[model samples]
Target: MKEQPNLRDATYQEEAAIDSNSTSIAGLVRQLTREVPSLFTKELALAKAEITEALNTTKAATIGMASGGIVLLGGFIMLLLSAVLGLSNVVAPWLAALIVGGVVCVVGMIMVSAGKKKLDPAAFKPERTINSMQKDKEAVKGKVA
Candidate 1:
């Protein structure tokens, strides 16, 4: 009769592979445990650096953009003067200028407020890195377990 294979006993390659896996997992777990904190610190530092750079850029751009806005506002005010003059045939000139200038300024401020909202620093939180760290934490837990 032919000899039957032993189901309970692992062969040489199987044992080797299992040992290799366990050793690698242990090594990876140790490396992760040691490096994750430092990695997070570095990432945070990078984010702060990038945000600071961005803030500086924003400041410079704001100056240029504000100048452009002023120039545009001057042009618009000139055009609105024509409209105000036309309206002055019916209403008083000062009333026309006040009504048109006030409405234009309010609309411009609203647009600026919308732009300001987009540039808010709080919106640039390190969400991606935080999520990656959380995922890595879960993966390390799975490996250790």
Candidate 2:
């Protein structure tokens, strides 16, 4: 994909050109007043686009995982049935089913626990957008100071 140019970079270049070309402080201030609002609107649009992209990615991945799980579930059920049948040859049928069921339940609990740990809110955080906003915050502070 072709990369989009950064709005901030373009804005900075425009500001630089304006600073050098303009002879009056009033003209510079007037230009800044007009640009700041547009800059903010562009930044918000960029952040919204980033967030939407992240959500779309997560949605696609979830759908794919759910589809794969449905297929795997059918195979898993057959495998479990085979295990129970094989064990039944060595033990009572009831005992074999109980044994397999218990093991499967325990394994499932462990997997759920691990999955819960991995499901931290941070996993879905918009790190790039947050970092960009932080940089912008610091730049604004520097300008103010």
Candidate 3:
């Protein structure tokens, strides 16, 4: 009863029996050179796009935070000015409270306006480039699954 040859094992053994002298590292590298550029280009583009998106997000967040801080500081300054005006009788007996109060009010209004401009939601809305990048990312993720 002769044993049947294992075709898978025989094929592997036949491949291993090839002349080792026929292959070289440079030939392997040459083969890879033909395949790698397209893959690398795809990966590089994805990375660049991801980085650009992250930077834009950071810029938006920073603007939002700075705006919030400015608004809060302006409110605090307004409160302090009110307190000073109320205590005018003791702090500066001769100073005209109305003049100082009016000036402070003007400054507060300016701060409020500046803060509002900074925090304007429309200003930070994603541009067309960012929107397209987001769509591309979503498409890639969809394909991955």
Candidate 4:
């Protein structure tokens, strides 16, 4: 009885048949032209998806920062008023306001710094899309050569 070819050998034979069918340079060029546009469209879709995801992430961060700013402003106003009242009898009221304002200013600065970090351009880079594009570029080059 004849033995069946192993999967690997069968795959190789199939690939060989395909390669032989397209052995001509014109065939290769036709294949490239047909495939490259499809590949480009897929890459563009991936890039668009990644950018949309990044933009969504940025939107969330922006909302957080905006919320933090509003809260910080309200907190600063309330705290300053309370601190001024509480310290008015202990120290000059102006000095108390100045001290409270400085502390609140520091807290706002911290919030701003955190927000700035989140908005970093590097963090928004479409890493997977970039890597995929590089691989596709190499693949195209190999096919051309």
Instruction: Report clashes for each candidate as comma-separated counts.
Output: 0, 0, 0, 0
What is the per-residue lDDT of model 3 for residues 63-97, given as tens digits with 9 covering 90 to 100?
A: 99889989988997787677667768566733646
Task: State the lDDT of candidate 1 residue by residue for 47-141, as single tens digits.
Answer: 67767777787789889989999999899878998989998888999998888888888988999899978887675565666776688678768
In model 2, what lDDT does residue 96 have? 100
Total clashes in model 3, counting residue pairs 3 or more apart in sequence or in different chains: 0
> Which sections of candidate 1 miss by over 4 Å?
1-33, 49-57
Local distance difference test scores for all models: 0.78, 0.82, 0.66, 0.84
Better of 1 and 2 by TM-score: 2
* Regions of model 3 farther than 4 Å from truth: 1-23, 86-89, 93-145
**Tens digit per residue, CA lDDT, model 4, 1-145:** 9998799998898678668858787768877887899988998999899999988977887799789889887986786798889988798988888887788789879978986776678976889989999999998898778
Q: Candidate 2 regions off by >4 Å? A: 1-32
Evaluate residue 138 in candidate 3 and report its C-alpha lDDT on the 0 to 100 scale: 75
lDDT of 2 by residue, 38-86 (tens): 7678778877887788788878987998999999999999999999999
RMSD of each: 10.5, 8.8, 12.3, 6.4
For model 4 the TM-score comes to 0.73
TM-score of 1: 0.59
Q: Compare the candidates by lDDT and give the number of the best one.
A: 4
Most accurate candidate by TM-score:
4
